[model samples]
Target: MERIRRLLQRKTLYEPLEGGSESPDGEPIPHSKQQPFSWLDYSVFLLLGVAMLWAWNMFLAAGPYFQRRFESDDRLLRNFQSAELSVSTVGNLGSMILLTKLQARASYPKRIVASLVLNIVVFTLLAVSTRLFLGVTASVYFAFLMLVVFSASLATGLCQNGVFAFVSGFGREEYTQGIMTGQGVAGVLPCIAQIVSVLSVPEKKSEQGAPLESSTSAFAYFLTASVVSTVTLAAFAFLLSRHSPRQRIKRSLDSEDSENDPERFVRKSVPLVRLLKKLFWLAGAVFLTFAVTMMFPVFTQQIQSVRDPHSAPRLFQPASFIPFAFLLWNIGDLIGRVSPAIPGLTLTSKPRLLFILSISRVIFIPMYLLCNLRGKGATISSDVFYLLVVQLLFGLSNGYIGSNCMMGFVEWVDEDEREAAGGFMSLCLVAGLTVGSFLSFFAAGSS
Candidate 1:
């Protein structure tokens, strides 16, 4: 009905108001003004596209590559460091979430840019510094890989929250759907990245028929992914600069909004207490869901430990099991994203049940642990199969939980609080990711 009214209003306005439309008063005329596309509207779409692609690229080459490098290869030192990396990466979620909350009360494009740039630079430098200090070599590169995983996890968590907060705007439905869709699509990048990894040129042999060395690892595929990601990031930065609070410098360049009144600079900031009260329930669910989700990483570590003396060596292998598991998980999530029908407009018949079902993952994780720990050899393959089934179901549970919980939270908050809620959501998600990583690595690595 609202959309229909807007359409009708647009049509009526374009029709020239029937030569003297007035509302029962001695007025000359009333004209309908179509709202102009604001910076907020344009930036949301721009960021949505870029963020999805950016996240996709981040995970595409990185997930499988890192899984194999840090978790697959059984280097004692690397294994130990990977566990450390998990804790640091997870712990960083606390800082990342808090910063987002702090930044929520204001919108300054330069500050946003500065924050993002600093976060990325610090993250990258930490990894590079660790690599150089440890003297990275294949023999001990697992140590560097551990640091890289840690840095990437932390950076990705921060970047995700930051990007969404700056980019998502007023209203619940469009914004929440946009996030879910982008994340869903982005989450699939590894499925394709796996295929791309297979296409890299193998090293050619010399006249002596001894093969020359090649620099690319299966994970070096991420270098290409990173380059692609850089392009998306630059585009996002450009769009954001044009449409975000960061547009101050651009305004100086173009001299637009020079006459800006003080009123244009202010937006109401919500209270922290108010925002937390709305999120309290969903926050618990998110925390529990993510904590349980850690079992997959643990399962991945165990699977990579599998060896067969008689099987042929294969290049460009994927964490096929994990991705497949998520594919199933995402399907369930899709179902949750769209709920079932209701009768007679009973408010009680709403889709809140989806959120409840999603919480079942907490129960499922223990079963996964029991299956994996039961054996190896003939038992390992069967254990892996059971783990995959559990993950597929887990994905379904995630879909239901994620679909409604976020939307419900947004509905409960005010317009101002919605922005703060976005930051809180990110914090909770990262905290979960961090915790999951820490527990998984410890369990998987502990013999």
Candidate 2:
């Protein structure tokens, strides 16, 4: 038992957490007194980069195909399927939260490494298999595809949760923003890939009445994704090996820690009731954001449907909004992430204020819808401009809202239940996203 405890208690990373005696202003430090991974930690950052690479390629390969394939489907089906996929992925987030909470208690690096490796393998398999088998139209193939998506979602959720947990243990609050930024960067690659596909014309049909077919360009996308994943896994393996050089926390220090310390324990365990309340509020915010953003997909689909009635539909590149608009949002978020240092930025600390501001777009969404419906009065450019402004505002609000979400829950809950609180909040956010997509499908049909 002593030997096992000693093995688990080793500290592998973080310079900032160890050097600072006082808490860094604004950054929440975990009770374990562990700091989050620092930028200096090459392995964590490298892993983040590799993950981002894989993420971008996977999106490139899969998103265009899915968008094109489903363009003509009933709005409700499109919405429902998208929501279902979102829900499955979000639900996996709950599992991730649980795992992180366990990691906090155990502090086992081996377990974390094993989980991460498994996630990579599972995700790679899903991406490769789904892309390759896409030509098969049988029910069996369809079921298999769905299964693969489910597995992919699980893998992604697991990876996200594990990273969050692992980073938190070291007291790294920046991990969240860093991860989000990585996601934003990864998005850029897919956008470029989609544009390239759009620019490439199909070969001219011969006079022999042969059907002109689109090349499987997306396969190159997925194949690139698989290679990125392979490289990421290799990097992770190397980083884990380097991890051993860092000093391990002595076993005596870990075993002595427990819930008996009232101040510490209370700080750690947030009440479940409080956590749920936070979820309801955050869910409402997410619902509002998703409701408006879901319009992007719907609008793209609508435009394509109108333009290509008889023509076999190809993927539309509205993913331009993802990299562009989402980049704007993330930049705002990055500002918020660093805002704790600025005196003025700290003024907007009220939970309700942030939440309301975040969801303010619910009012604007109706107007965008109204304009979109009044088609003859407004030019397409005018309508699109209006829509873009609304989205930008939405992104800005989200910048504040997403950060508030983490802060608000922390304020609401006592410290101990932080994991459960965060998990529940994530679950609600995901649910709202799923519901929003589902609603948008029907709403598009009506429009």
Candidate 3:
């Protein structure tokens, strides 16, 4: 037990520093005198972070299903994704700004709890709407679906901002890394659920051509998401409770932060733009990273498997190929997100290297485009192995560069500044997402 505790307590990679902190005013910042972080605390944070993005992932995983719903209407089905992303991104950005304006109370637990409850509601509505709207016009159904997307988007912004702010308040890079890692896992979960939902539910004949997927599988998918949210909600609620040992330790740190730097608790001009350099190009790096990643679920979903009928596995079939691809990318992303826990992997505080790396990720566009995309005979390679390699590298770079930028920025700032940095970082991230959502329109058109 002692050996395990010692191993888990190892120091995380941070900026090049001499184990000291300095405030903006040049005063030394003291380290926390709180209890040691236990394994349970790490698990709770990771799980809660996973829950934070669960709804969005599930929605993306259900994209093909949504297209199926619009099968009869060629126009709507063709452009449903573009419109859906627009609505969700608009809602996400607007809500994040609103929440930032109202975040003076630092009601982290309440914000997270409310968002989780909202997510459960949104997923439930998605599950029900598929069957309930079978008789309605496709346009009406798409409108209703967009509303659900907006709700989930709103919840996502709230939960993510809350989690980021809460973790940043403590100024612990390990916690931040853990939460980001959990988010990568969040991406992975829906892929598994998607496959399960598709395989478990029986398909029936459509009035038109081929068979259609049943809402039963979708119900199970959303239900699984609801259960995850429920479990994470309970866990977060307990962390806020006074009885939990972990909560007590964290609360002490929070109290100390408040007492030591009362100015941070009060709102002031954040100088968000001024922080561009101090943040070590994290804002721009994150912005570009996600903007490029806009290819995912949009352009990515278009990459059909090139199967060798003579020796292909069932997973390479049309029914399961997309989800399997999603799984591989997310698994690679999870690996990259967790890798920074090791020292020097991200080269903290090195802006030039990070910036170059971020810019270089644009090469993935050609890599993906050159694949047997759209089955349009523009192929550099038709090998499924080649496509898998591209996805793994794509996801790995996304997580590694993004995580390092944020982690490096967090480490470079003082504890007092971290709370502000947190909000700023999240803003940049969402800004990236919003731009990516718009860019995906052009990407889809070109493809």
**Most accurate candidate by TM-score:** 3
Ranked by TM-score, top first:
3, 2, 1
By lDDT, highest first, what's the ranking?
A: 3, 1, 2
TM-score of 2: 0.65
Give the better candidate number (2 or 3) by lDDT.
Answer: 3
Tens-digit lDDT string for candidate 3 (361-381) = 888887778765765544655
Worst 10 residues of 2 by lDDT: 19-28
Of 1 and 2, the candidate ahead on lDDT is 1
Could you give candidate 1's per-residue lDDT for residues 1-447 as a string of tens digits? 999998986553222111121111211111113223454544354344334334334533343333333333445423454554454556467667556656423443333344344435533443343334433444465555455555555555555555445433434244454455555555455445543343344534434332222223432444444443454456555554443343333345444543563322334455656666766667666666666665555554344313342351332122243344444454454444344112221121233353365466667655555443413443335534453466556665664465455545554554445545666766776677677776765666553
Better of 1 and 2 by TM-score: 2
Model 1 root mean square deviation, Cα atoms: 10.2
How many pairs of residues collide in each model? 6, 19, 0
Please give each candidate's TM-score.
0.63, 0.65, 0.83
In order, what lDDT does every prediction score?
Answer: 0.46, 0.45, 0.71
In model 2, how many backbone clashes occur?
A: 19
Instruction: Write down the TM-score for model 3.
Output: 0.83
Candidate that scores best on lDDT: 3
